[model samples]
Target: MLRPVTRYADDLSYVHHTGFADLARGAARFVVDLIGPERRRVVDLGCGSGIVLRALTDAGHEAIGVDLSPAMLALAKRTAPRARLLQGSLYRVPLPSTDLILAIGEPLNYLEPDARPPALAAFFRKVARALPRGGRFLFDVIVDAPGRPLSRRAWAAGEDWAVLVDTTEDAARTRLTRDVTSFVRRGRRWRRTRELHHVRVLRTVDLRRLLRDAGFAVRVRTSYGEHPLAERRRAFLCTKR
Candidate 1:
């Protein structure tokens, strides 16, 4: 069975942080720019392995990273040692009082979105509650779009590890499921691991409306600053009124 929304495990987290951190790295500049020169408390929701957190701290922000994965947070410790890190769901964790909240890599799309309003209205409201007037939220989500194919397969490799992902969209269910397999060099041999992840395919219109109702002024974008996002995905730059 495909896994429901949950914290990433050891192998996948390792592979992702090591081999596929570029997107987060690129988004970091855009994130840092948005915060300006003033010191602000920034909370990274689902911070993964802290590529962005590193950038945030390096730019002089008070940074806090929250993730449900111990493995990922462990990596964050090395990447941004000066930042405070916590382990918990973005939806359940106590968001540190912050001027910015970031959920990059479309973390909210993996919420196992059941029957509540899109954008997970309650969670958006919680974020709104945590922010003061003019607080910012930078995040992205995979959405049903004009040219998204029904299935996709890709692979990435580093000097010591490699990963393959096969993904399929279930339009009827409004979700996408990914089967991830990884190989890590342990000695003379490579160890293999596999897992599945599911993400809901969000509707952009619904997301915008929900965010607006949650008290955010939302701007939809197809890129992070000048760094282009993958097709069928969108970033939401939201500000609390």
Candidate 2:
């Protein structure tokens, strides 16, 4: 077998789009409300499969989406045809000047470069430079909280696709790993794809300090408003002030 890809592929993206859709669907209302009826330019980093892009466009925002996975961007194109979809990493992408930036789904956590706090600190500076005073940087980060599980296995299935994931969290090292295998039905045959994802457990305190250093006023919350994110995932609303 080939070495597991580090990012989402076709089958894996499809599985997530179909099976874990509650994450995107549940986030729609709360995120939209954060837009506050303004027709602002919104850039979505790691805009997977475009569910939130569709929501942003439907709400009249000029939405630009960036992701490293072409497979995920393909689905996102169909999901939000009106939104401009760019294939690029959030860490390396040329982010456009925008009134608001959305990095929902913990997009900042999974990329390998973010293994260090300085990488994320540089990213925050970039985001700060890409926005003007009063602009918003709304995103979430996964923290290594106390009493969290060390390792876990989970699975999700749909009519034509299934996903199995083995997750390992190391608190001492501040890392999270997911070994994911996806099986998708293709013309009466099942195709399997595997990918490994790693997330750095960047602390909220460090991230808040970085945001503040980058000229943002940061607030941490468990939810956007009504939609409580999965455990340990905390949202940050950073306004350039």
**Over the stretch 1-241, how does candidate 1's per-residue lDDT look in tens digits?**
5445455778788898988887898799899888899999999998999999999999999999998789999999999999999987788887767899999998888753232323388889999988999999889998887885658899989999999989988856487778788999988999898877767888899889889999999999999887899989899999998
Q: Residue 49, candidate 2: how far off, in angstroms?
A: 0.3
Give me the runs in candidate 1 sitting further than 4 Å from their true place. Answer: 1-5, 112-119
For 143-181, candidate 2 gives per-residue lDDT tens digits of 865556647998888899988899998848487788898
- Can you tell me which runs of candidate 2 are displaced by over 4 Å? 1-5, 113-118, 171-173
Return the TM-score for each candidate structure.
Answer: 0.94, 0.93
* Whole-model Cα lDDT of every candidate shown, in order: 0.86, 0.83
**Clashes per candidate, residues 3 or more apart or on different chains:** 0, 0
> With candidate 1 superimposed using the best TM-score fit, by how many Å does residue 239's alpha carbon deviate from the native?
1.0
The candidate scoring highest on lDDT is 1
Candidate 1 overall lDDT versus native? 0.86
